[model samples]
Target: MRRLAALVSLLLLPLLLPTPAQAAATPLQVYGAWHCGDDACIWGNVRSTTDFDAKNHWLIDRGDGRPSVNVVVLSFVHPVKLLHKTTDAQTLDGVPRGMTADIVNYFAGRGIRVMLSIGGITYTTAWNSALAENAAQFGRNAAEVAQRLGVGIEIDYEENSKPDLVGLQAFIDAYRSVLPYDPSGANPAARLTIDLAAGDRWLIDIGRKATADWLRTDTPVLDYANAMVPARQPSSSDAIANWQEHLDGKPTYSPPIPPLAPAKFTGAFYIAEGNKVRAECADFTASLQKSTGSFVQTAAPKGAGLTPGMLGYMFWAAERPSTKGVTTTPPNSCEGGVGGGATAYAIPIPMPALRQS
Candidate 1:
């Protein structure tokens, strides 16, 4: 009788143990910042090494010989020009003059990953036109740029109201055809990703489609999605609420949107807000990154994902997001906020292997 009772207890012990999601959380794999210039997301001019490094040194060496983030995304490559394969004195092989190899090498040399963003809010019409014209070709062109630069590509098509989902799919397919998904993270060009709105409310169609089909862990399409920041900086509670929406999808929609895996995306915050240095860029303790750190690390999976916590954090506009906004340059660098956060999080440089599920 005693032996039988012990056997029963031993069998039930497995059930009592915490599931993977409830277990100890893992550190964030991705910590990135998007780079933009004063020219409204366009790096228009080719800058010399000295000039470029002077303004951007803070990114590479965050006060203590460490980088602020593991990755840097160069913002706003013209989709129309890339689609048309346009080239001129200002553009080379459909890439901007400013997005040169030297610039990419600057970061890559320092154990940082670099990516090129293909669209922004200002290029909504352009994205529509390009998708309408030749999305497959556009994807091929983007793949070509990625190959040439040895960098990854980010699809930032912010067509909230009427996104060209079909075209976007074709674009993704074509790009994947050229550079297939690489789980090993060896091929940089294979590291494709997309940008989603802060919450499931906006970018409804794209978000619905992305969450349902593209971002599935069983059969992944893009590497991941970025939950971009809202118009203004959101408080810790507001930001978590927004992130929670992605974890808990809307079921009442036409074809119910599914919950995204916590490992499949990163939450974004504003580094600076129009001439004002945000806490994310200036002060770590007061920053949303610090306030929301625990939630970001241990939030359990809702309906999808076996892992706890979202992928990691991403900061908005590294250099100068806008002409009017405070630039993340020199005296106003993100060493305190972003850098301190990096140290606090012990963010792995060159971005270690990410959790697939």
Candidate 2:
């Protein structure tokens, strides 16, 4: 009799569950911050791993309510000045291959994932040389640095007009081959990802590589791609449309671009919008759960994409790279630079989706 009663309860479980409209709103997906400490720090002092104080809110909580980001991608490990030759040497805040575990751990201890982002717009010359000549060394150097510092690696190389696809592959392969992931290792949560042009038009070549090749492989070398801010901010609806256009090719191209599944793209936004024309983004605080699926090309509720509902969110920066000391929409807590939302922290996973995993 008890077994029959239990079986009846199991069968009725679906009825007991909340319907789509009745469910609670889901948590935001992919809450991340780009920590640009590699010298955009003149207005804001350079961030040293060993350093500490009240202003290090980017590294830790300061009793305020700013959401602690789940992921922190340390900015810019640019190539050395010798652009003609391939060199393994890279620099962070003018320190060749300099990185420290203290900063990595300061956030890691708080359950955040840390990564090292290589190449920014300013380091264009170095990118041309490193990828053109020292591809393997550059990749190895980046991976090795992240390995040493106990963090992941992010490729932000922006030379899209003529990207070195062959060299890039070599770089990725080298980085992956050397730094095998072991959850128990010092940098167990380490991941290898890349920065993509915000939209399809600018980094045409690189975007092609991402859609036609990188994302389609069974064992993709990259974990995912971050859609950096496009020239203009499109609304959340427009943003999703742009992502769809990239993944599922629009009709205008001479040869319609091949489409990739929606799962690989993570739309990035500028967190500290002030006077600039904002990307047509939805409210920064808009809940992923509350969004509908008009843009994502799926029947699932908004934000659900690929393996994890839409790879998740990445802020242009943790500290505004150029907007030092400028007051942002949400006034900052840290000094010298604009620290938009560092008062608290959050996990990157989608709340409702985590249950499936």
Candidate 3:
């Protein structure tokens, strides 16, 4: 009987190897650290006068042989004013006052694909006005900046209370029109993405409306939705479940929005403040590693709805907070530091490969 049982277990192992429902066939790429860490983030909090210190803010490759997150969201292009935009520009406050193009190229030269995030939490009104006033121009401007700087675009629209679906879609259409996606990777190495609320409870309306069109079928304009972090204390379960339900909508949806394929989503979270690292964030990492259980990675589509898994994780930041003290010295402060945050998520959570694309 023991011998027979052993034989049966061995036979079942092969059957368990493939997760058919997974979004991608390859093991899901770990897309960690959607950083805007510390003063270097420039877009979030304005800090010291030096641009050199901001560039080396994050210490990604520590020479410890641990797998660190490969990508960092260079962060923030707040308050879009493209109506009179120019290729050479500076931040409103002039904190990151220097040649923006050179700063962008510095990271790219080191093999890190930097994505320029447009719209922060405070710039909701600006986003509304920018998209509503001139979506095409806004798109062109975004594309121009992305092209010239050789970076990608991340629309961090946090208008959960009253999201402008029409205007948002218009922006997507306009941006994609100018910077269209090509399947063969022939297009310039530019990535486009957006942020949605953590779950359906808060942004339920969007989950229903967007599933039918914006996210489900428009792969050329956007990559996947980064379900922004700072939900309930332990929001991973709800976040993952919301994405799961997104793939298969709830019964109560009015007009019943189309289900979003898992291939079109990624979970995001914070690595600072009340969001506990060991207890809270690590569980989120485990769930993401599991591909939210019901989800999987795939590349069969290769078109409008290409590749799979929850597209990957986006951490709140990659820099140690100012409260953590200037972890690194001057000159290197731009891309250095991790004082109290040494064992933070960087090496624990799987990081994306140096995203050169």
**Which has the greatest TM-score?**
1
Ranking by TM-score: 1, 2, 3
Candidate 3 worst ten-residue window by lDDT: 333-342
Quickly count the clashes in candidate 3: 21
If both were scored by TM-score, which would come out higher, candidate 1 or candidate 3? 1
| Residue 244, candidate 1: alpha-carbon lDDT | 95
- Evaluated at residue 133, the lDDT of candidate 1 is 96
What's the lDDT for residue 47 in model 3? Answer: 38
Tens-place lDDT digits, model 1, residues 203-223: 899999888888888998889
Measured by lDDT, the strongest candidate is 1
- lDDT by residue for model 2 over 194-277, one digit each (tens)? 887766776777777766666553445566678787764456676666665656554476544555444555666664455442
lDDT values for all models: 0.90, 0.55, 0.53
Question: Could you tell me the lDDT of residue 166 within candidate 3?
Answer: 80
Q: lDDT by residue for model 3 over 1-357, one digit each (tens)?
A: 999999999999988797666342444443545555455444434334355434443434433523234445665565454434633344533123332555555555545556767777767787887777777777777777777667777788777677777877777777788777543333433467677666555566666656556565543346556766654434446555655555555657565645555566666644443423432223433433333433434323323343444455555655443344332333322121222122333333323331121
